[model samples]
Structure formats: structure tokens, C-alpha cells
Target: MSTHSISLLLVGIEGSEFRLAAEMARANGADVSTADTVDAALTHLRTHGADLVMIDICLDAISFLERMRSERLSAPVIACGIDAPARLAVAAIHAGARDYLPLPPEAELIAAAIQTFANRMAAPIEIEALVGHTVADVERELILQTLERCHGNRTSASTILGISVRTMRNKLRTFIEAGIPVSPAA
Candidate 1:
């Protein structure tokens, strides 16, 4: 089965707003869940590994962020509210929300919001993830990881790495000739 990126937790939004947000997120491939309070959201996060979080600004979102910090819940957060003032959006960001999503959801905006966070799912390259002891080894690993991130789509990985598709194909060929297993190109 194809994996969907949205394992979203919705907190404090109710009635039409909650339904709408969930529907929009689902329409854009999110597997959405809900929580009416901060404690409940925390409990859910602790139990279920996930995800991008969306909490209503009208609720005690700042408190949630503080508690999430104290509890070390590392999921990135997004704030949602109806007619929220500018200060509140700034405050949400200051409190560690990745972005704000205004309510009475719009599909395009939800897609954009999901895309913004989806891009962050690529983990940073770490020393431990690299194999072998040479600069060539690092370069090979980076290219392979980037290709994996792009789901074996050479064109996309090439664009991100600022290289051409021909070069990517050549590199993959070289790696394969060297007995390195590579993802099948899409």
C-alpha cells in the first residue's frame, strides 16, 4: 500500500470546523485523528507515534507547546483559529508551532500546509548514517538517500541536488556496476 504522509492530530477545534479540517486533510492524504484538550492530545501522541499537530489558537495552545516541550513530544505543531489576530499567529510561531492554518478549511491551503511539513520529513544526514571512510562514500550515500527521499524519482532528486537527470542516471549506473543496490527508478 502507498503510505500517506499525514498522520495528523487535531486538537480543540469543534463541530463544522473540526469536520472540515479533518475532511480537507484526508482529502489531501492525511490520516487524521482528534483530541479536544491538551492533555488528551499529549496522551494520544505518547501512545501513537506520529505526526504533524494542528491545534486551535482559541485553546491554550501555548500551554500545550510548553507541556509538549516539558514532555519532549517532538512532533511539529501548526496552529488553527478563526479570525485570529496577527499577534496570536506570531505567538504560536514563537511557542514552536511550525505554521498557522486558518479555519473553515480550504483544500488548496491544506495541501500546501501538508506539503510544507512533508518536506521536513527528510531527516538530516548524520555521521552515523554514513558508511565507509571516504569522501566518495559520503557522496554516494547522500545521492542514494536523496533518491530514496524522492521515491526513486531521478528527476526530482536531481532537481533538488542541482544535478541533471543524465548525471543521476550515470551515477546510479556506476554504483550498480560497483555492486551497490539502488532503488529501481520510477
Candidate 2:
């Protein structure tokens, strides 16, 4: 796919990683925008059309993905961070991200990830992607159990899960991952 065919939103609090991602995106020919906060990123999504988002979930921006899915943003998102937890990565994909990659990512990896997300976004959501007893299901169950222990208080749940609130938010995305269908009752 041509990079010009897609718009990329690069989000992270002010830092070198954000700059690196933006530069890589530009080199790949993707029209790119930078957002310092999840709120700003959401505004950009509302005002401008983006094909994908490269996010630093380390800054606790995972909830932004959940909110995006909850709001029904059609564009695919990709979470990028260094040493991001497996749960967070899974949650991001579940929340509707086409993929996730570790930060300090190679330029080619970023480009490829973007291309893959673009391709996937162009297709219809496939129910077969959600099969019996997926890893997402197990993680969601764990998260729900933790939430119940915390009495639905996300802060407490995050503490119990040993992750940041942003990571917790990303985990919530798994509940909405395409055809996964994690219900409130689950």
C-alpha cells in the first residue's frame, strides 16, 4: 500500500520516541500528526481521518485505545512501547488495534506494521479471528476477576494487576476486539 493512502497519528507525551515515530512515518510517506495527550489524539481522530495510530502505551495511553473502540473509531491502531506487558499488547489488539510492536522499533518494522494495519482495516471484520478460548479470553477473565476484587475501581484493579491505568485501559480494549464480544457479565 502507498503511504500517501494512509494517515498516521503518532501519540506520546513529549519525548524522543514520539519524534522518532513521526520521522519514520514521514519517511514512509504517511501523512502524520503528533498528539501529546490522549484527549488531543481523540480530538484529532474526530476532526481528521487517520488510518492508524502509533501509540506509546507506556505513557499510560492504553485507555485512549479503549475509548477509541468504545466510540467506534473505524481506523486501526497500533501500540508501540518498550517492554510493554503481554497483557497490554493483547488488550490493544483486542480493543481493535490491528497490531502492537515494542518501542525503539525499527523503521522497517513500523512501516510494515502500518501497512499490515492498513490492509486489515480495508477488509471486513472476520468472526473467525475470535475462536474458542483465545488468549484474549483468558486475559479478559483475569482482568474481570481483578476488577471484581477491586470492586470495579480501575485504580485498585491497576494496582492489583501491577500495571498502570493506561495499561489497564488497553487491556479493556480486548473486550471489544473485533468479534471477541466480552460482555459486562463476563
Candidate 3:
């Protein structure tokens, strides 16, 4: 958890990974709350404050983000989904999510997110990388990094990125055609 007693809200459909997130956050020393619907989450937010909110991307995440913005909710939200597509993840980011949490949540990843949000810091984001960069640019950069991290294995990269192998191939082709060097397959 982030520090001690940091409050966290996990909102999503019933039986989703949100439950695990709540458990993990709680186990990590956070005061965790759960809401099965966006409306309920918003209602709670209307009266309570949270250090971080982990919302399911499938739960009309964009609408929820818009509502949060309209309601002036300041809690940082991390969108979570099981095998969510890269496009949807990007859309969530564009809609105001600070980050996307991969489903079957990785323990360390969730912990790091909790710590970052609770501390009111975003060190993993590297703001210097976002300076005046377009979303497509960032997307491309991420794909390349994932590819490298996977030792040029497209399948592994696609899985990590929550994108289809076909999409990965297409992006790699595009990058290559654009003269952007991709690591040779290993």
C-alpha cells in the first residue's frame, strides 16, 4: 500500500479483478473500498475522498472519467481490464486515466501504482518523455520498448501490451516502412 491507511476505491463489474485489487491494496496496508458499479463509485466519491481509484476499463471507463472531471474529482484513476486492447487502453488514458492496470493484476505493478498515487507522485511516468509528444508517438515508443523488453518476440510484446499479434505486426510493419528501426527478431 501507499504509506499507511491510504484510502483506495476499486470499481468494476462483479467478479472482476477489482476484487483482487481491493484485497491487494488492503493487504498492503491501505483502507480499501469496493463498488460494483460506476454510479455507486461516484456516489461514494461525492461524499468521500480516496488517494487512488482503480476502475475497470470495461465499466464505461471513458464516461466515468468524464464524470469525474465534471464532478471535479481529484483522485488519480488507474484503469484496469483483462486483456484489454491497446486502443482501449490508449482511449482510457486520453479520457483521463493516469495509467492502465493489466488484469490478473501483477502484485508488484499494483503495489507500485498504489505507492505512487498515495505518495502523490508519478515517477514511473517520466514526465520528461511526455513533453509535447503526441499520443501516437508515445504509443509507438511503448510498443518499441515492449518489443525490446521481450527480446524482439512479437507474441510476447503483444501479450504484454494487451494488443493482438496482428496489431503488433501491423504496427511493426508501419514502423519499418516509416524507417523506424525495430529490433530484429530474436
Candidate 4:
């Protein structure tokens, strides 16, 4: 388990359900905050920085998610909706949601989601400490790992890393310029 506490933002969630979810998250070792609107969520995010965001499906979740991404809120988002249409769920994902859950979310699921996010958020820190590496070193290692996993195919690695092939090439160039050895493409 990570020593760092996981912070979570809940958008447009209220009532007894919100209370229960908040309690469950706290019990699972998370610090949680709430927002009633997109603007409020953004404000909370700017001030507190969340590892994960849970947006109520009723709050025009797709739009909120798009706005968050536009604002560079990199936290993984979870859309919580009640019997939402498949189209709506797909739209939410396209808008940058990492997961979608039914309304009145189950406590176990919420805890699991938070745990997953926490693990993701803790990874870089753990890597850095374990290897005594800088951010660039970690990034280079990750890119190389992805490239290897993709069989040295730049396009596939870039796609998996959510970067353009051009960007991947540029990063590789930087590594080469720094005299870092990289395996040739297969």
C-alpha cells in the first residue's frame, strides 16, 4: 500500500447516497470532496487536485468531462449514471471518462475504483523512489517498455501511450541525443 493518501472529487453528487459513498471512500483510505456543478468541481480541482473524479450522470456528465479534459484536469473520471443509455455511456467514455457506474454506486465497487486510481497515482512515485530516477528517466523507461511491448512499432506504442507517432519519435530523438542506448526497431 502507498503512504500517499488518495484524494477524490465527487461532482454533482448529493443526498444520502453521497454520504454513504463518502463514508465508504474514507473507510477505504481516501480523502474526498464534493461539488454541485461543473464550475464548482473545477474550482475544487484547482484548489485540491484529485486523483480521481466521480461525476454524476445527471450533470451533463459528457460535457463536464469534456470541459475537464479541456482544462487539463488529468484525474481519471468515473461517470455515475442511473440506467443510462448505451449511447450516453459511450459518449461519456469518448468525453474522457475512465469508468462508468450505475447510480447509487455499490460501496465495494467505489472502494475498488478508488484503490485502482490510488495504485495508478502511486506508480510513478514508487518507480522514481525505487530507481532513483528523474521524471524524464521514468518517461523514457515507460516509452521504451511500451515500444518493446509493441514489438518496436512506433505507431502502436504511441497509440497505446495516447501520443502521436511524431511525439514518440521526438522523445526517442531526445534519448538518443542524450546518448541513451535504445534497441533498434524490430
Give each model a TM-score: 0.63, 0.59, 0.62, 0.67
Residue-level lDDT of model 2, residues 83-161, one tens digit each, is 8789878776555555677878689887787677657667777567556778867667778778877666776677555
> What is the alpha-carbon lDDT for the whole of candidate 2?
0.73
What would the TM-score be for candidate 2 when compared with the true structure?
0.59
C-alpha lDDT of residue 52 in model 4:
85
lDDT of 4 by residue, 1-186 (tens): 456789888886567364567777788888888888888988888788888888877788888877776787778788887777888887786566777887676878987888787787777655436476777877899999999888888866775676788999999999889998766876
Model 3 regions more than 4 Å off: 1-3, 121-186
Instruction: Give me candidate 4's TM-score against the actual structure.
Output: 0.67
Q: Which is the leading candidate under lDDT?
A: 3
Error of 1 at 100 (Å): 1.3
**lDDT, model 1:** 0.81
TM-score of 1: 0.63
Candidate 2 residue runs with Cα over 4 Å from true position: 1-3, 117-186
Q: How would you encode candidate 3's per-residue C-alpha lDDT over 37-144 as one tens digit per residue?
A: 899999989889787888988888889989998998878888999998999999887677878888988778877886766666423557796989999999999999
> Which is the better candidate, 1 or 4, if ranked by TM-score?
4
Rank the candidate models, highest lDDT first: 3, 1, 4, 2
Could you tell me which residue pairs clash in candidate 1?
none
Off by over 4 Å in 4: 16-19, 125-160, 163-186
